[model samples]
Target: MKLIDLNPQGGIGANSIYLQIGDVNILIDSGLNPKQAGRLAMPDFSLIKDISLDLIIITHCHLDHIGSLPVIMRQHPNAKVVMTHSSKMILDRMLHNSANVMLRQKEENNIPDYPLFTHEEVDRCVPRFTGMEFLQPQKFKGKTDEVEIMMHHAGHVAGACAVELHHKDRHIFVTGDVLFENQRTLRGAQFPSGHFDTVIMETTRGTTERQVGKERVNEVSRLIASINDTINRGGSFLLPVFALGRMQEILSIIHDARKFGRLVKCPIYAAGMGMALADYFDEISRKYQHVQFNRNIIKELNIQPTARKLDAGKDLKQNALYIISSGMLVERTPSYTLASGLIGSDKNTIGFVGYCDPDTPGGQLLQAKQGEDFTFATANVTTKLQARVERFELSGHADREELAEFAIQTQARSVVLTHGDQAARDWFTKELESKMPGSKIIDPVPLKTYEL
Candidate 1:
């Protein structure tokens, strides 16, 4: 088997790995960089433009993982796109919303080739999609060898999964974005751990561990208390959330907190693609009752949808929790607009519940001190920082310890780390060294390939 690094620099942006075993070639994921613009944002599709892929396996529907998919599909129209039934239901919403965001960027910033691929292109690719149920092995009809594929529950999002390929006497696993601990809407992944030749996995959260000395439940309780404190103080609380898993998890956590009287009851609101995803979660949960997460958490919580763009100078009136998308408060998102209006209020809280790139507006605000004046170029607004800005361990990725534990479980002779920054990979390299000293750890340098 030859493992090819298709990512441009392999530094956690635009992740794509070309796996060629026997006669067939499989592209693990097709992602677009969230930080770059135009063709530069793509995963150098030029790398595999000449190769014919038998299958394109997507791990989830997140933009960084699935955004540039249509760009490749337009080239290999016959390739079968495989994902979970849950991912299939949300892919359309994600792509369409992405198209809208790109169009807006084109008009506002004059970003040439901004849309990348149109909504019409995305619509055309759906018929060829094959959404499979979890753990059901499907044989791939390749030319040279017999390969059976299975997607285990990834537990990151509603339908996210870890890809397992059983070929001949070998087992190869590629963990998409993974979360081992159970969250509100889904249970953690139960991978079929055994001996293996190669395991390509994510190291997205290795740089930092989960909240120190607190289990996930306790960490959440603290977040709820913070939310309650702000609401009770008559200040609106803004939760800048990603529209997918984070939105659902936060909604459920807030709901349960209020239901059990652990948090003060207050109005809750959610906006953008998250509301659409909640509908899918409800559908999946109702159909698959055995699944650990409940999809109807939004309905149960009575979380209202906030106005897409709050009028300038008109902030939220009452004590409430407003959940908005673009977790990092990207310009044009509801969170960005709302943050502009609430940044000066001392009683208000702008809680960041997930990872933020240090260069993004959200990251900048998180690092800012009280009473500091900062400008958000995205929203074209400047404000003084007085509100509380806090980050929770409410991450979608497993922490460093959890990742180490998973690496040891695989027992693979070679463990290849993908999908993390320099600090995260360095931490994992040392952690895995201490934990699994018997195995070989391969860190794929940007634009370089490692053979196993």
Candidate 2:
């Protein structure tokens, strides 16, 4: 088997992999970078432009995983795209939202190459998508070779999956952004326990250790208590989240807390793509039984939409809980704007609940010491970071130790690492090498091809 990393910049953005097994050619995913603009954000399709792709597998609908699907589909018209059934249900909506965001960015940021794919293009790509069920093997034929593909539940989001492929006697497993611990809206990963010839896995949480009392259940309780503390003190709490899964899961957890009277009585405000996607989550919960989100959670919580225009560096002082998107607090996002306003005041609190890239504003804020001056360059606001900034261990990705254990158990002859920063991948490399001393661990450089 031969493989190439098509994500030119690597480090978790524009995630794409090109693999050739026998005569079959496959593209795992084609994502876009959240921080970069224009064509720079997408995977370098030029690397595979001349090769005719046989299959395109989608692990989930996260923007960082499927953001550039339309572009890739257009490039390889004959390729068949496959994902879990639940992902297919929500895939078009996610792509349409991406298109809208790109359109808005093109105007707001004055970028000439924005809106890389239009709504019509996404609509056309919808028909080419084929949804598969868990553990159901589907065979695809190339010019002279055939491979069987199956998906397993990967608990990071509603429709996330881990791919398993079989070609002759060689077996391959690809863990695409997985989480073993269950979340409120979704169950934990249900991976098969066995050996494979090759294993490819994500190293998202490689550098972070799960501290003793910071487990998911305790973290939920702590989050509720902190929200009550902030509201009682007449300050608002901001939770920047990823709209696809984290938003729905957090909403469900908050609802459970409020239902049991553990949460304080305070107005909850949520808006943007997350709220819009709630209906889809509800449908997926009912139709697919993969997710457990309900639209009624919003009604019961008396959720209100955030104001259309939030003034930078001016606190709203609503003393409410705000759950907004762009989890990394990317520039010009709703959370970014609101954070600028809230971070200046000692009364407010900003809590993060998911993974944040070290280069993003969220990661920068996490590393900043209290009383330091933080700048929101896009908002033109620079103020002392007086707000209480906290992080709860409620990330969607699996813990590094758990992931390492899973990789060790596979006992594959070769292990490939993807979807993490340099430090994170280095940690995985060391751990895997120490545990599986005889295995060939390859961290392929971007655009480089390696044979195994």
Candidate 3:
């Protein structure tokens, strides 16, 4: 069996991996950088074109994991798309929403390479998807023989899974963004203990030790308390979060805190796609009992519509506590506009709750030196909002120790790391090598293939 690494980070690429076993070819997680839209067109399948892909398995609905689905399906119309039922639903909604946003931005900014695929393409791709339940093994007979596929809960998102493939007496496990720490919206990843010939793992947060589990909850609570204190003094609190997992988790936690009287009963407004995702969370809460908020509690969580345009400064000024998305604030989303408008107002506090790419505008803001002022243009008016910016150690990925523990438990002969920056991957590789002296760790470069 051969595994190919398609995309890495730091312009290295994104998350796309190709696995070829004898006559069968399987592509896992076809992703693309949002900044490079046109480049996400169908990949050159010449290498595996002759060998028809038997299946395409998606780990989750995150754009970074399933963004290039339309392109891939357009290229290989016969390949079957496999994912969890919940993942498929979320993916359908996410792709449509993302396409709409891309088109709107293209039309407004006259940016080239807008939506790569039309809504019809997304529709075509949707029907091809086959939802598989977790832990249920599916048998796929290739032109040669049968290949066994097993899906395990990844716990990164609502329906994410880590795929295990068995063929020709070989066992390979693909870890697609596994989560070690449980959050308010999702449970920790489930591992199937067994010896494997090869294991593919994601190293998104390998370099740093994630905030200790117990400390993280405390930090979040403390940050909210601080914000509430400011709000009690007639101030507003702004929390910029990702519209997906992070937003839902934060809202659930806040709701619980308020219910227990840990925080004030101030108005909590959820903005942007966050509002929609929160509603979805409420709808699906019944199915995933491990999620932090129960159906009744999530039902009571308040959600406010996101600002429609870039200049909706007036809408932001009225809320006591607001949660907005486009987590990194790279795009001109409602969060960015509102944050720009309320920054300098001593009456407001801005908090960050997700990973931020340092090159993005939001990352710069997060790392801004003390006493720095930022100017924001809103509603044809320029306002300098100088508010305190703080970050909480709330991440969906596993920490160094957790990754080591997972690797130890897997007991795989060969370990491969993907989906992290060079430094992070290197650090993790070293750590794993020292801890597991008997196991071999390999960090694959883009397009680099390793055989097991």
Candidate 4:
């Protein structure tokens, strides 16, 4: 078997890996770097763009993992696309939404590669996708060899999965953005106690060893308390969420809070593709009994869809909770527009609920003080950030301790870490080295092949 890391300069952006078991060449993911644009966002496809892949397995529909899929499917038209049924439903919404976002970016930012692939391409790619249920074995029988592949829930999003590839004596496991703890809308990854020859795991949060004495339950309690306080103060609260997992998780939490009388009722609003995904989540919960999902929590939460021009209606109408998208508040998104409108007010709360890249507008807002003047770079909209700014760690990825425990449980002979910064990767490298001394911890070079 052979393994190659397509993403060398990694940080949870363009994650792609080439795994060849016998004569079958399968690509784990073809993702676009969220930080980059046009061709730069894509994984180094120059590695095997021309070669026809036996299969292309997508773990989920997040942009970092599935954004560049159309770009590759355009090249390798014959490769069978496989993902979970829930992912298929979510992907359809996300990719179409992405195309529209790119079109908007092209017109506004003068970006040449704004819509990297057209909606037409995404439309064409859907028919080719083979949506499968978790734990089902998918076999690829070559003339001389046979490899069995199974997709298991990764617990990162609605339909994220980890791929288990086995050929003869060698078994390889690819942990695709895995999470171990249960979230509001999804459960943790469900891979059982097992051993493999090689394990390719993500190191997204490996570097940020969570602050001691801070627990997830405490974080949740604090966030709920913060929300309740902001609303009780008659301040409009804004939660900027990613449309996929974070939005669903946040909504579920808020819905439960309201149900239990922990949160007093105000107007609840949800906008962007997240509203669409809630329906899909409801559908998945009904169709797949195994999926740990809520049944139309968005509907039950009385969350009205906000207008596209959210700024016009965001008049701080007495203790309303606004849940909007483009979690990072990237330029033209509704969250940014609403935030720009509310930044000048002292009675409002702009709460960020997920990881914000410091390069994004949302991340920059994290550094701004109460009296500091802030400007939305995308729109040149300026305001004094008098509004209360609170950030909570509702990240979907597992933390350092969880990841280390995953490595310990998998018991793979060799482990390769991807999807994190240098410090994060270094931390995991050292920890794994000390803990799993019997196994090899490989620090892979981008685009370099490591044979097993």
Screening candidate 4 with a backbone cut-off below 3 angstroms (N, C-alpha, C), the clashing residue pairs are: 8-446, 207-424
Q: Write the per-residue lDDT of candidate 4 for residues 1-452, one digit (tens) a residue.
A: 77788874666688888887898888888888777777888898888866678889999888888888898888888888889888887786788887887788789778887789898999999899889878989788655778898888888788899888889888888889887878877878888567888888888787566785556677787788888787888888899999888887888888888888888778898788887787788788778754555745666787787865555324556578999998988777889888888878888888887778777889899989889889986566778788999888678888888888878777788999887877788999999999998999987888888887
User: Which candidate number would show the highest lDDT if scored against the true structure?
Assistant: 2
Q: Encode model 1's per-residue lDDT on 1-452: one tens digit a residue.
A: 77776777677668888877777778888888887888887887665678788999989988988888998889888788998888888887898888998999899889989899898988998887889988899988668776789999887787889998988888888888888888877888778767777888899887785655567887898898898889888999999999988887788887788778898878888887887777777777877642444656677778787865585434676788888888988766788888888888898999998888776789889999999997867666778888899888888888878767877888888899999887888888888877788899988865554667
Sort the predicted structures by TM-score, highest score first. Answer: 2, 1, 4, 3
**Candidate 3 per-residue C-alpha lDDT over 1-452 given as tens digits, one digit per residue, 9 for 90 to 100:** 78777663432234677888776788888776654545543233444556577789999877777776787777788888898766865788888876787788678767687777788888877889899878889988678877789988888778788999998888889888878668878888887886887888888776666554546778777777877886877778888887778778877778777788788766766676766776667666666554554445445755555446645344356647887787877556778777776776767788887767665667778877656655443234344545778777777777667777778777788898887777778887888898778988988766666786
TM-score against native, each model: 0.95, 0.99, 0.90, 0.93
Q: Which pairs of residues collide in model 2?
A: none
Residue 395 shift from truth in candidate 3, angstroms: 1.0
Global lDDT scores for all candidate models: 0.82, 0.93, 0.73, 0.82
**Cα-based lDDT at residue 452, candidate 4:** 74
Off by over 4 Å in 1: 289-300, 311-314
Highest TM-score against the true fold, candidate: 2
**Model 3: per-residue Cα lDDT at residue 362:** 78
Q: Which should have the higher TM-score, number 1 or number 2?
A: 2
C-alpha RMSD of candidate 2: 0.8
Candidate 2 vs 3: which has more lDDT: 2
